[model samples]
Target: MAGHKIPHFQNDAGHSAIEIGVKEFMCVGANPPFDHPHEFLDMGAETEKVCPYCSTLYKFNPALAETETVPAGCTLTTEAA
Candidate 1:
């Protein structure tokens, strides 16, 4: 993201996955006191989305098991990892 101050959701592997069914979400660079304008993000068939306002990139992973945010390859989200 531009300026690198833009905040994004990330797993322990530094790769973040958007959960299924939660297609629409809000993108804010920071919280409360330092928050930017709330940008609405739509996760379509594409795997990645970027917020125009904050330049934050949001990724959708089909392998997230429908109930998780982290990818299947993520160690932090699985027991067998």
Candidate 2:
């Protein structure tokens, strides 16, 4: 054989790993008590947005800061590192 190519396979040998890091994320939304006269004129005004997963009410002030992480055996920890 001129050259042997090694075939790659996925295994669980290195599945368990841990990663620790910090990130800053900002969430913004349309101003509540909206500044626009047209919006205020509307009787049914929905001013706030919510997070689908956490159901956090989106706001304009102080934004939102959070520490997010994945478990030791999570695939994200392995791929994102």
Candidate 3:
């Protein structure tokens, strides 16, 4: 059996909802063609924050173990703009 790898960054599809670690990352406005600029957001402080551009909801799930990666319903599909 093999262990799944966790990527440093991913797209908005699987990123719509997430539970992140202490690392700092950015959020882009749109999905692809209509995407906007990237804005860095910190998850260490709040439980959730909405993207000003795309209006997607982002959440922090503290229940997940550090060894775990992306949340359920997420695919690690795309990257930032």
Candidate 4:
């Protein structure tokens, strides 16, 4: 994730689980200000993982793009400094 754009996602809808396209990404808990610490998560050989801070389960979906997330609009488009 160091020289690349590791997709950042948020659980704005407060969904219990989210289906994501990539196996590696970041969970921001929610939007800025109120958002928790940005955490990097990897599923490795698994299909799902839960964010340690937010406890939001992320399921892998091969059909979706790296920037895509189920329920839509969950992908944080702007980069955090």
lDDT of 2 by residue, 1-81 (tens): 124321111112222222212221222111333112111111123434333323333222223212222332211111111
Model 2 scores a C-alpha lDDT of: 0.23
lDDT of 3 by residue, 1-81 (tens): 125333233344635655554234455543567556765555556777666666655665556543333554332333332
Q: Clashes in model 4: which pairs?
A: none
Off by over 4 Å in 3: 1-23, 63-81
The per-model lDDT (C-alpha) reads 0.46, 0.23, 0.49, 0.87
TM-score of 4: 0.88
Per-residue lDDT value at 59 in model 3: 60
TM-scores for every predicted model: 0.46, 0.19, 0.47, 0.88
Candidate number achieving the greatest TM-score relative to the actual structure: 4
Off by over 4 Å in 2: 1-47, 62-81
Model 2 / residue 40 / CA error / Å? 26
Across 1-81, the per-residue lDDT of candidate 4 in tens digits comes to 556678889998899999999998889998766599888899999999999998999999999998888888899863532
In order of TM-score, best first, we have 4, 3, 1, 2
Off by over 4 Å in 4: 78-81
In candidate 1, what are the lDDT values of residues 1-81, reduced to their tens digit?
Answer: 123222233233333333432444555544445456666566767767876755655666555543345443322211110
The order by descending lDDT is 4, 3, 1, 2
In angstroms, the error of model 2 at 42 is: 21
Residues forming the 10-long window of minimal summed lDDT in candidate 1: 72-81
